[model samples]
Target: MTPTQIAALIVAGAFVLLVVLLAIPLVKLGRTLDEATVAIRKAHENTDPIFTGANSTLTHVNTQLERVDGITANAKTVSGNVSALSSLFTATLGGPLVKTAAFSYGVSKALRARRKRKEEPWGKHSRRKGGRK
Candidate 1:
């Protein structure tokens, strides 16, 4: 009946209307959130097998890399051994082999020179006979 009481009632009614209007959208938002959560869970479930397969492939690749690393390590060791053996063989055999080769070459050259000297006398006799004619 009073003007102040009427204003208070109008304000309360307006607040109630605002709450009712806001509740509809809030309910819709909650449902949408629930649907999104379900869809995300399903997506994760569907991709689980793919993720597992990728993990298995990665594990296999790691295993293969380990084998490759082992092979490389063995190859490196073999290379070192071969280099050392070559050095040892060179040190043991290189000097005597080089000396023997030099001696054999010198003897062959001396024999060839002796043969050439023996033929020189016949070559001079033939040249002198030809000049007389």
Candidate 2:
């Protein structure tokens, strides 16, 4: 064979070896992409039920919140009513009750002072002198 032909044959063999080496990695990359696609699909399938459950839980929580809102409204109304009743009681009876308490305290103090004066001995002089009056 000629030297030129032999050189061309060697070049072709090297080109084939290079293509074979490149193709192996390309095939492995394609397989890895396929696995990634499958994993994504499985994750999507798994998350659907989780999302549904979350939606249901949110719905129940909202329902409970609405009930709490109703209870809060009732409590607010009761508080307002109690405040009005307290104001009414204060307006009606607070002044009279204070006056009565003051009068009773004054009467009790006067009675105690009178009783103390009477208890002092008739034969003994009062705080002014220790000798008999």
Look at candidate 1 and tell me the lDDT of residue 117: 59
**How many clashes does each candidate structure show, in the order listed?**
0, 0
Count backbone overlaps in model 2. Answer: 0
Model 1 C-alpha lDDT versus the unseen true structure = 0.91
> Candidate 1, which ten residues in sequence have the lowest lDDT sum?
124-133
Model 1 segments beyond 4 Å from truth?
100-133
Q: What would the TM-score be for candidate 1 when compared with the true structure? A: 0.63
lDDT of each: 0.91, 0.91
- What tens digits encode model 1's per-residue C-alpha lDDT throughout 1-133? 9999999999999999999999999999999999999999999999989999999999999999999999999999999999999899889998889899999999999998778756774564344654433
Clashing pairs in 2: none
